[model samples]
Target: MNLYNLNPKYRILVTGGAGFIGSNLCESLLANGNTVVCLDNFATGKKSNVTPFLSNKKFTLIDGDIRNLSDCHKACEKVDYVLHQAALGSVPRSMNDPITSNDVNVTGFLNMLVAARDAKVKRFVYAASSSTYGDSKNMPKIEDVIGKPLSPYAITKYVNELYADVFSKTYGLETIGLRYFNVFGRRQDPAGAYAAVIPKFVMQLMNHESPHVNGDGSFSRDFTYIDNVIQMNIKSLVTNNTLAVNTVYNVAYGKRTSLNELLDLLKEYLTEFDLKIGSVKTTYGPIRKGDVPHSLASIEKAKELVGYNPEYNIREGLREAVQWYWNNLK
Candidate 1:
């Protein structure tokens, strides 16, 4: 799909626009000549992420919390579309603090949906989680078949799908849910206890520190690239296909790589920058709670429905991510 082929400029509202995924979306949208309104509380979002866009006349930054209904309403004003990316995103974080997770992921999500519906936006595309595929040993996860949620975070995301479905039926709001897998790339933070595995490993290996493997290095994930995710979100917004609305799609690379394989790739890439990184060994620990053994995506549904053709695989995406880290973070 050609991202630049979008016909008319749109006024888009991206919640959590100061966060990794949201910031990337904002950059892409602005490059494509669209006006962007970003809503972020800076709780988990960093100001450095959106700092570059501060000078853009087409960009507006709203320092607000998604937990507050007024902030949601304020962000949705005069916006054509809403890409809802705001949420507390770590499984372990949710397991530790279920109340806050529910309040943000579930209640905050509801606030966005209500604001979008009330504002009469053209579409509402929110971030969903692959964690919702809990306990279903399905090799290539499809959209229809989902198991019970394994954690409070997963529970909240699943409830988002339910609420979005209800809103589409009850209020006729156009909605789509992108169930993202282990998405990683440039600007993804490498610090914090809840940092994603790819960035964490890259940061650790860069510092000549041994990164810990949560299991016997057997667990695998469909490590999707941020560019592929951007394609999906843009397609979700501009697609005129009637069948594409009010549904969820798997946003992933449609391939899985084990932690052992992943670590090897990181070392191989980082070693090019510093030979010592190759010698950094890994420390293995017991599997963490609320984690599945494997995750792969059946992106066929997305391919068939929304014309989603992912542009990057694991190695291609990883190499790019490594280069980005080496240039920007190192």
Candidate 2:
């Protein structure tokens, strides 16, 4: 699915454009012939991610922080749409420093919302999270139904939806929130303590080290691929459906994979490059706090509303990601 070909290109501002998912969005937009201005403070985003686009005539990188209103205003200048991806991610990180997480995720989000509203962008599409589903034990998580936030990071993301809702209602700004599941793919950072499961495991397995599974390895998640997420963002950006506007959709592959199953797939894919990766053992640990046992999204809302059809499932995405890491990061 070539999403860029489906809509008329416009000048877009991508906050956190130097991050994993943000860089991919910038690349896709630029490839489709849209002008892109990227704003980043490099707090969690890496400069290498945007270095490839520095030479593009249509690409501009603004060294700025989303927490500052002035920076948000500067980034939003003359932008047609805002794909707000800037936020402090990871539940463990949030648990460690709730104050900083709230400041960046909540306050920074409001800054972007106000700036986008003032700039009069066509629409504001921000990254929400599956963590917002919290303790809801529902197998196939839906949009409307939610539970109490399990961690500070989840609280911050949920607050973003509330603020976006109010901004749309009170200020007449067009907004869409995509509740992303456990998103993973190429360029996803695996070095940090908050590194995602896939990349972390891939790196560990690549080094012939034991990858640790939290708990009995039965805890599952709707591990979404970056390409599918990009599709959802583009769909949210271009969709003219009245009902879809000012709403949230689950951005996921609509399937769940257990931790043990995830390791098997990663090994299967990575072993093609180095046979030793297949023999790497895994260690099990107690499940961390604020961690849910299972998470799966009902992407029917996205399919019905934004025409989201994920082309890459777990196996397909993991194959590409493992290859990228092997070639680039190995």
Candidate 3:
């Protein structure tokens, strides 16, 4: 179902390789016998995430900030491919401090692009957010059609796609952007104020606390798993089709789950371990600013081009996520 036969053959650099998605990518790249150089400043990245890989002979960790062009250049040295995942992510966080968000997401992104171009890397695959589909009533969002951005974070991610396009056209650097929806899995930090909904809810429910739901728990998202994203990233790197090089792809499980349904599923899974979790309630609150009511993705582009067939649905991934939190945090 996946292009698992193709193994990476060159050195790769993963910026923000200590964060949730970044760390997972680093692990996969290294496991496939590629030399991995991980660049992370640990602003939001956890040291524990990368600690397990520290002893691997093929793995190297560079403690550097992507905001600094010199640091970016340093990380790009001798790297054949760049998986750019470094950025301050969270719509609400950007809403509170748009200036900082711009600096990290926009300026830092430009620095990585320039560094990748200067180093003559074969390809640059950067994480694009689904928030870019802002204010659009479109269901099953495709790659081509996008609406105006709703938040500073969305603006920064949309700008990333623009920069990638410009780099591909102007500098001839191969680039691909994966527009990820609500990605969730093990190792995604659930302790922060801006933690993602799934992980946040898992932790709250584990503690027997009523998880809060925004807007009557009607909002939904195309919750994708970590493995599906990793598959898409690997596919983006290994694909030989020239037309698929300089474009974007929607990364999701092709299904949406509402908040209320998600909580019910989580409780159902957790109750297998503890009977009391089944009685936990959910709190409703006003919808937060920069929030969208629903999100779904048309993954046909990815499937037709790169053969990206996601293996995990919300229930499958949520079961694993809840188990991890119970085993690790309980």
Candidate 4:
């Protein structure tokens, strides 16, 4: 009956749509009969990620920088929804170049917010991060309780939420923030210094390199899958609840998986490819600055408010993710 249908003429703008999470969102939106306009600067995003969908009639790509106001405004023209995902993404990388990171994550986010507000889009959905928890000792992090930001990147993401709230109050814009927790899956790049732990560890194990485990393999995360992320985005964009507007949700599976457990799971999944592979040995390194000792989320609010249900746990997510890496990258 096409109950989930939106206006076929509805055009959506996905900034950083060539990046991992953004590209996945773009693909999902296009599948559901929406015109997707993707704007990317290719800083951390790769062209290959978006190449497969180039010929889609409803998809358009604009190779542009979000740090530039003109580019942000150009992409927002005639868009019904704005999914802002472009930013400098890593804790360590932000430490190395805090100025550039702030420029892109903070200043650039402000630029996008201004553009989206002026365009008067139906909704603005953004990729917020769990790193906003900072050094808070809470086990299951609630949206209300937060601590001082531990890193430049954390500061940037937290600032996004702040600006979104202000935009909603001042400009009457509809904004939803999804605070993602260690999201990983297919097409997640593994070949960089700032590579996420899941992909980076899988790649190292595939090549028989010793994977480094920081801080005794005890630090944990509430790793979420890409599909769950997509689900949250869809719900955020279309929800009828007034309470959801100008609100932030913890987008995660609500389960904690330690680093040691994750590595063991990866090795077990990858061994099916080559049983004779070397033992997956990991070297312990000192803990990193700005790194949270542990992270877990209380997704109760998201569940109650938006009907947000995460379908993948760590094992299931890693299973699918490792298979993708084996098939494509290996």
* The candidate that achieves the highest lDDT relative to the unseen native structure: 1
Judging by TM-score, tell me the better candidate of 3 and 4: 3
Instruction: Give the alpha carbon lDDT tens digit for every residue of 184-244 in model 4.
Output: 9999999889999999999999999999988999999999999999888888888898998
TM-score winner between candidates 1 and 4? 1
Q: Rank by lDDT, descending?
A: 1, 2, 3, 4
For each candidate, what is the lDDT? Answer: 0.94, 0.93, 0.92, 0.91
What is the TM-score of candidate 4? 0.97
Model 4 regions lying over 4 Å from their true place: 1-8
lDDT of 3 by residue, 1-330 (tens): 223654556899999999999999989887888889999999999999999999999999999998999999999999999999999999999999999999999999999999999999999999999999998888989888989999999999999999999999999999999999999998999898899998899888888999998889988999999999999998899889887889999999999999888889999999999899999989998999999999999999999888899999888898888888889888
What are the RMSDs of all candidates, in order? 1.1, 1.1, 1.3, 1.3
Error of 2 at 310 (Å): 0.5
Candidate 1 backbone collisions, by pair? none
Off by over 4 Å in 3: 1-3
Query: Which lDDT value does model 3 have at 14?
Result: 95
14-126, model 2: which lDDT tens digit per residue? 99999999999998998887899999999999999999999999999999998899999999999999999998899999999999999999999999999999999999999
lDDT of 4: 0.91
Error of 3 at 77 (Å): 0.7
